[model samples]
Target: MPHPDLLFPPDREVRAIARELFALTRDLPLICPHGHVDPALIADDAPFGDPARLFVVPDHYVTRMLLSQGIPPAELGVPSVDGTTVQADGRKIWHLLAANWHLFRGTPSRLWLEQTFADVFGVETPLSPDTADDVYDLLSERLAEPAYRPRALFTRFGIETLATTESPLDDLSAHARLAAEGWGGPGGRVITTFRPDDVVDLEWAGWAERVERLGEVAGADTSTFTGYLTALRSRREAFIAAGATSSDHGHPTAATADLGPEGAAAVFERGLHGTATAADAESFRAHMILEFARMSIEDGLVMQLHPGSVRNHNRWLHATHGRDVGGDIPQATDYVRGLEPLLSRHGNDPRLRVVVYTLDETTFSREIAPLAGGYASVYIGAPWWFLDSPDGLRRFREAVTDTAGFYNTAGFVDDTRAFCSIPVRHAIARRVDAAHCARLVAEHRLDADEAAETVVDLAYRLPRRIFRLDRSAA
Candidate 1:
């Protein structure tokens, strides 16, 4: 019941085995193949600003909880788009979280925050209204230290490689800086992933302007459909040259289209002219997923598809606060039919590697597991977003393991924007997996040695191999 071993299983016999398994993987190097940590932090090696800006302001997991309890976002210093000023006090913001610590009693955010405070900042006392000031002072002092700089912590966290998402318009100057310094071979390295949703989705805000910018950045004409495809290919090549190994798509649905060139051109024209019907927009988005797959097949970059989130569900918040402010909500997704067009063309190919994630948990047993099990190119993505908690992860293993098995799954991905929570999230997953493996040993489903190997694979090796980091650009 101590803070050190909070997540370990309770059974006497199983706890011992789980503890042993945890010991094996607790010190292994971290493999973070997917995340949203800003590369500028690492490139500039700047010290984190303050407790609230570093933790509360940027993390939706923290802000959404406070908002649900009737607290206005401005109280927590959430920025506004119309040039209005919010609260400017950092210590006061920390007090709000400390006072409401009970709200996170059984939540994963509590676990991650506690571990971060204790391990990362040496703040061992429980956070509360009484202890808030002292904890704030301690964290503030620590954030000013040289060792707490982003690059230093990247090395201290024992991360072998960390991937950050970028758009096609990004020149990857930060990544380019790291590459030129030869920082990726042995010491910690940061890489970029191609996230083309802004340019690919016709309904997205500023899509026409973004497409025009993409064309300019790629040095290709945006006037024709053929020219657009060529520009997309050029952008992918730029990502590859800047040390990217994957492309990420966060489409609203998993639909894929295989329209002929003429049909595709018509859709492209509608998108360019800003006269696209909703159906035409959907058709264009769907067709681009197939084009992305084809490009992946040729370029050797892994393709990641995560669909089924009805983004910006809180229209009031979106209009006031812009996107990714914890307003996104998940909807049910259909994979068997939605991905048929893409899979039919590239599913059997050994050269292509596609990892798919879903917010709809029901599809795990019924659709995604079976699809990954049968296809050579498809691999199941780990639990993400709303499903990244302890119970959700256990349920994912139970549902998918029978059909897809261990090898067919792309290992764990943190998928976080909270930089300090990276190690905490990975640690929680490793403990959960070790507990699962311990249960298998207790039930005689697996021998101890084999279970140890499985835990290592789930935690480290599979991520490296699945993301192709073993031979990734140095």
Candidate 2:
């Protein structure tokens, strides 16, 4: 499974240039400014359980494809909410994935998985019903080795720094431990990002309880609207103490509102009582985006707004399996009118850094690029979720470059929960960027030296600078 020319152009002259650019950036330390990898895994530094658990079970990208083709998640060892029925045998799960390998053809999941197998696990033979057991045994042996431990692999991955998302209620004990161990300090780094969706979204199930927990965590009286904002600000300060450089919002849309104190408090009262209407929920989320930006200005944490995914689209699956089980689907998102309120308030502020991500590709050229082009605070996020493939990556570069240009865009972030795929994901991104840059060189739109510099910026410099990851808070 050699991907020597995986995403490189077929033209020999163009590919030679791409290879040169790739050589310059292929081994740079990974800047995972945004992702969903559990910090507990890095803090605990434990050995991975088995091959199937490491590969198939935890990856929604892998499980979703299997589930889409009539395979129940239970059959693939994905635990239900109650843990009543999930495939318990690792070998059996591997066999199942092996039998259905063809389902991932032409998919990014397949490219990442195969690259991981070859590069990370040293597996050369293709996986299939025949080689499943052999591959499983080899992976089991490799995973048992000391180098395969979470912390060891963290170093092996050459990660300059990593950030994991957490709720406001999180105590950040793992981050504290990492800091105590000198991991999140000057040299080693693993920080947290504040994700307040559970408490901010009025329609979220258990929103009341999460807010109460937030009150306890922040030691604020959340019974009043003012106190709730205090609680949020307090928790954000706590996250900053734990080495957070950014705050994330996963709202359903890019909406923002600027209601004054009385109006905001009235909406908060309705939300606190669980009597808020659908419009109220939208209004509250919109208002909070503005508030989060204000907080970012005061605290210096970069703001990341990821919108447009309709989470848990399958109602039955959502009820049975809970969230992030590959049930989230992309929807069309409007950024211009939706973000007008917030942009009008803080778009020109040089102190604020807002990274905007969308699952909808349609918004890249027409809406997102233009917005980033105008606002000093806004930066267009990389192609994400459904648009993270090679073609998607190229399309993103093409779409946004014309308006936003390279500097107005944030560099690549994996946004993955799958740990082993980090290197492969970054490698693919580097290659795709090189290919894009080589084309610009070929067409004389950019000089070769300039393209080389741009490729490094896309790969290494921009993400570090944009996320403020280069700062030594400790």
Candidate 3:
């Protein structure tokens, strides 16, 4: 049997109320409007390879926690950019994971994994060191079956829509292919998001080469600043054609600058020549933020800014392992003065939609809620990264709901690499939201019927409206 402590809705008086609330929204169709799962998995529609690759490697949340215990990432099968072999044994990796599973107690990762194993795979036995091999063999055999393929699992999970992030240099052929073939019947919508961080940041390695490639793809000169901007614009249009509804920006800070035409051009030229100083590069990036805002206004794609991450904190790990392998750390961020330039220019515009996210939880009540509460274009995103857990979600609702309320906050986004955890994560969010609403109802702040309606809004409707997925035809 599964562990008694595995389930959420802890055994207490509150558990009864939480159970009722969970029942109301348990089977709601999942709307995963934003995430980081690869498009190729959905496009190819192939069965997952093995248990190790499926569970241990692709999930940075799991590996990062394991690394905290002195386990190297190479042993977890995190591939290098040049295609080096790491851990190859599925059972060994599973054993390692099971031994350290206690490290994830009370974490959302543990909750999602337990739910995926019990609810999806029907594994009655809890994952412990004793049962690791048995679970691995069972999962491996199941994954080889036809029903476990990406598209089939997507359908089985009741995922209405999934958006994958793509770089500006990406051709998006996979997304185009999925759209053309219609993977999920007549309207299999696997959309793309425009993430231009690699090309936008002047400090990134091979920035000039990526810019040249962007120009080549968009059929622009790219040697000058104007040409570079045109190339980026063209790429955005191409992504829009492939069924994108949003653009994502992951800047080091929320800072934005409103530079004059000449000043912007000068910075861009310096970037092209690779002669831009650190301050010059930052100024240019800030100017580009304004340009991105203007482009969002023109293109009608929602803008999402995820700031305050100090990516690749361990340079040696980055040198050996590369990015997105669980080395990124969060830092304190400022959204008031940082976002003033962009907001002053376009904050009142009704056509624009900008969702802001922060790793700095202090900003929720102090800065973000007020900023989004007043601005026409701004809405606060759900707590992300380190703050995506049950406790984090609860803290977020308690902190921001007073000022921002239900409307000013955009609903949940999985923001995960683990595909199987999508429904589980969303389910947890719905339950927590319902529990929060139940508290409000108990306090006589909101009626029972109103709480029910708001629960549905938080579960399904809010994300659709925020991400523009509620278009009449969709």
Candidate 4:
């Protein structure tokens, strides 16, 4: 039997109203402005290998929860960093995930998985230990169909554009291929986002080598600080040519430092020698952030900063498994003090687009909203990472709406690795936003028509505008 709460918007009258509002915008093409999905997947346009990789391993939301329950990641088919096989049998992993599905009972992962199963694969039976084989077989069968290929699924999902993050060392060959083939010329678009985490942080492993490679790619000397910055600039241009419209930064904090050129050069010199103190490294990073903002003003690329994750908190897990396997945790972060330098420099600039995201909910009302509300260039990103659930999304809207209003925020970005869950995530976001809007209408704060329009804006229009996709060549 289907779950009683399966039908969203729970109240009949509210559900009817929400459904009516959803109908107006539910089919609007998706604008995935920011995500971590591999650009190569879209470039290759290959069929996914199996259900385990599709549903279990790539989804940190699913795997990390399972890991918390003492489930070994290897048993769930998570590949090792060295590319060794972990689990070859998909059925066993599916059964394990099914048996322990209760771990996600109250979580958004449960909601998304259920929606994916029902809406995408046409599965009506609930997933459980007994039904694991049945569900896996059904998904596998669907995967075999031509309609389920990456590009085909992108079209079916109504994704007008999807921006995938890429490291600085990357050649953007996949994005180049997509553009060369004109895949994004007419019906679909896949663009790259310049992610320079590996190159920016002097603390990162292989930073020196990655810096050299960045210089090599850009035909710069890279032995000096000026050469390094120039190489990054050139790479940004290259990414732009391949359809990129944004740059993403995953900093540990929202700190930004606007040091003068001499001060910045001193810090960069320390970084180059691998002898920089922690303070010097941080200052260099901050100075580079200011530089990135200046570059944004010049290049017309949006700047997205996702800060506050204490990445790889679990050293044992990181050693055994590596980063981004659900071991990262959030810490309280300060944005006001951290961002003061950058804001003082470029806050009034209309051409520079800086979207700030946080795992620290405390900042929404007190800091983020107020800053974004006032600044021409600043905007708050949607609920992200650990907070992308229903309750989290609701709190975000409630906390910021009074201060920032709707327009100061960028709409939803799925920020997911699980390709099949894209539509599922977007559907949940839309429904939640509509339900919130419905409450506003019920209270007479907003007319029904305005609420309806806001639903469409939140779902489709805001993301396009904030990500600057409408200006993109289609």
Candidate 5:
């Protein structure tokens, strides 16, 4: 069971205020603007296969930490890209996770998993080597129930709107099926997000093929630069038609460029031909960020820039398991200089909504808060990636609250790949926000009523308003 004061302040007066502030958000519905839950899982509404698949095999956070402790992914039933060999036994993986549970202490992974084990699965006995099989047996039995299906859990979790990301090359058959089933639109439960990284990032391994596939899907020519832009526009329209309200760009940096069409076209052709140098690719990506911004202004799709992640940093793991196996690392980001091109041109535009997320926390006070404070288009995204923890969330509030304020922020987003962690993650964020606000009230900085209202915004209103979800829903 969750303790009443899990993430609250320890002081008597402040803890009381924190508890009061949290009550306002306890029953509030979740508004997840960005996440990586597979659409097929909800579309199929099938029973989760087993305990290991639900909690261990698919979550990179869990696997990466275990891998860091010198545990092979093969031992945890993680199959390779080729699917050549895999550990097929579920009980064995569960045993390994349980025995190694001690490694998660004082970590966010433990916070999420333990809360999930207690609240989601109704297990509070604590997990360890001795009780691994007992817990696994309980999870397997509950997952077998129809109530434990993905859609059932979605409804039970009080998720008002959940957006899953897809690439330009994707057919979005899962999203199409979801819409056909009536789980879409501004007010609908599930939606898709336009992620064009695969098609736009020139140095990506299959960039040429992904662009060709984009042309095929959108019925536009790709051999020419004009044709390529047309193809990208068509795909954006397709994404919008399938209920996408935003476009996500995951770049190496927050760089933006405004190159003329001829200059861009020269680089584009060189890129597709595999003749573009590293500098050429970087410039092309910067220019495309500006192009995507223009597209966002033309269309209604909000733009999101998630930059500064050195993705797939582990060469061996990346080669063997492919991406999202948690080898990414965050480096320092120069948001001020990098975003100048886009901000100088379109930062004041009321129509353009650019929510910026950074893996680099050092930029929170220096570059990010100041930028959001200066520009009308930019809104600071919630603590993202590795920073989605208790202390990280608190630090974000402390860092940006002075400059950006609560309204200028995009509110909390559970930018997670794990399905089971969504509710617990949101719960943790709410507690952290409440406690942060409580400190303000305790210091006589704000009134209790005012703090309560702000937390409600942090919990529900700001996400919907900044993400433009409440332009339609409450």
Candidate 6:
């Protein structure tokens, strides 16, 4: 269970001040401008099924840690794409988690799950092999309650706004279903974000087929570069019509380009015919990042770039289970050089809103902060992915606060597929930000009144303003 003063500074004076700051934002409705929770979870409004499927199967944080301890994926209920039968017993998976609960010590996953078990389900007993069955039965009983249904939990969670990401190839039937039921609009809670990674990456499996379907869905030709851009623009409009205020991109690097018309067309044609070399694929992806920036200026979707991830690094798992079951590693990012083309063109445009997230911590002070500090258009993304831990958030503030300051940053994004972890993650950010502010106050650098406002802005408002979620429906 989380103590009342959890994560507070040990210094008595600063700890008191930190409590003051956290209180200002503790109950503010969450603004989840970017995340991976499936909208169908709420649109369907179904039971969460069981504790294993809810906490262990879909949560990579738990699975990744257990995998590091030499546990097979089959024991954790991970379904394989290669038709391998995996464990289907919920009680057994929960027992495995209990048997290895000690592995989570000092990880953000431990903090999240402990608080989730306490606050969400009112389970305060320490999880252990001896107590596993009792805890499992208690969780099973609570999950069977109507109060624990996904939609009921959303309302109970006080999520004022939530955004789920989808590729351009997605018809967004779930979002459409929610919108028709009065769930997404000017004051609605659930919305979609337009993610074009599937159609943009020329080397992705089934890329050509997805591009053809993109044209079909948008009612435009995709044979030529111009037609392809038109189809992309059409999809952006569809996303906007469905209440998307932002577009997301995940590339291997922060590279951007100005390939001009002919170069892009040649690459597009080569890609269509499956003759594009690796260089052709890389350069075309770089060009699309910049193209999307230009499109953001025209069409009003905030552009979010997540770069420097060599996704699916665990080859055997991906070969059998498909992508997103962990194994994305960060590499060094060259933001200064990679983004020059886009920044040189649109960095001064106030109409352009670009939030860049890096898996590389070195880029925080060296590249990203300076870029956000200089450009009116660019904003620093919050600590994300593997770096969203308590120390990681503190490190982010320590590194970037001097260069970019608070307002130039786009605050916290849960960026999670684990829906129940949203409030806990935000609580972690709040506690860390309060601690950061309390440190400044202890050193007499910032006033307490100002820290109060800063905590609220970081906790709730900055994402709303940056993602244009506060704007009325377009």
Top candidate by lDDT:
6
Q: Estimate the lDDT of model 6.
A: 0.91
TM-score of 1: 0.97
RMSD per prediction, one decimal?
1.8, 1.5, 2.2, 2.2, 1.2, 1.3
Between candidates 1 and 5, name the one with more favorable lDDT. Answer: 5
The lDDT-based order of candidates, best leading, equals 6, 2, 5, 1, 4, 3
lDDT for model 1, please.
0.88
Candidate 3 lDDT, 1-474, residue by residue in tens: 233222344546445555666677778888776789889889888888787788888888898898889998888888776777888887788889999989999887888888888777777677889888888888877888888888888889988888889999998888878877874212246888899999989988888899999999999999888898899899999888877888999988899997788998888788888898888878877888899989999988899999999989978678778998888999999899999999999999988999999999999999999999989999989889999988899999998888889988889899987888788788778878877887776667887788878888888888888888776622
Question: In model 4, what are the clashing residue pairs, if there are any?
Answer: none
State the number of backbone clashes in model 4. 0
Q: In candidate 3, how many Å is residue 366 off? A: 0.6
Tens digits of lDDT, candidate 5, 34-99: 988888888888888889888899888899999999997878888888886878799999999988
The alpha-carbon lDDT assigned to residue 393 of candidate 4 equals 91
C-alpha local distance difference test of each model: 0.88, 0.90, 0.84, 0.84, 0.89, 0.91
| Worst 10-residue lDDT window, candidate 5 | 465-474
In candidate 3, stretches whose alpha carbon ends up further than 4 angstroms from where it belongs are 1-15, 81-85, 183-188
Alpha-carbon TM-score of each model against the true structure: 0.97, 0.98, 0.95, 0.95, 0.98, 0.98
Query: What is candidate 2's local distance difference test score?
Result: 0.90
Candidate 6 residue lDDT tens string, 1-474? 588789889999999999989989889999999999999998999888789999999888888889888997888999998878999999999999999999998999988898998888889988999999999999999999999988888988899999999999888899989999999744479999999999999988888888888899999898778989999999999889889999999999899998999999999999999999988888999999989998999998999999999989988878877789886778888999999999999999998999999989988999999999999999999998989999999999999999999989998999999898888899889999999999999999998888888999888889889999887522
Which whole-number lDDT from 0 to 100 does residue 439 have in model 4? 74
Q: Which segments of candidate 1 are over 4 A away from where they belong?
A: 1-4, 184-188, 472-474
Tens digits of per-residue lDDT, candidate 2, 240-292, equal 88888899999999999888888889998998888999899999899999888
Alpha-carbon runs more than 4 Å astray in model 2: 185-188, 472-474
Candidate 6 at residue 430, lDDT?
A: 93
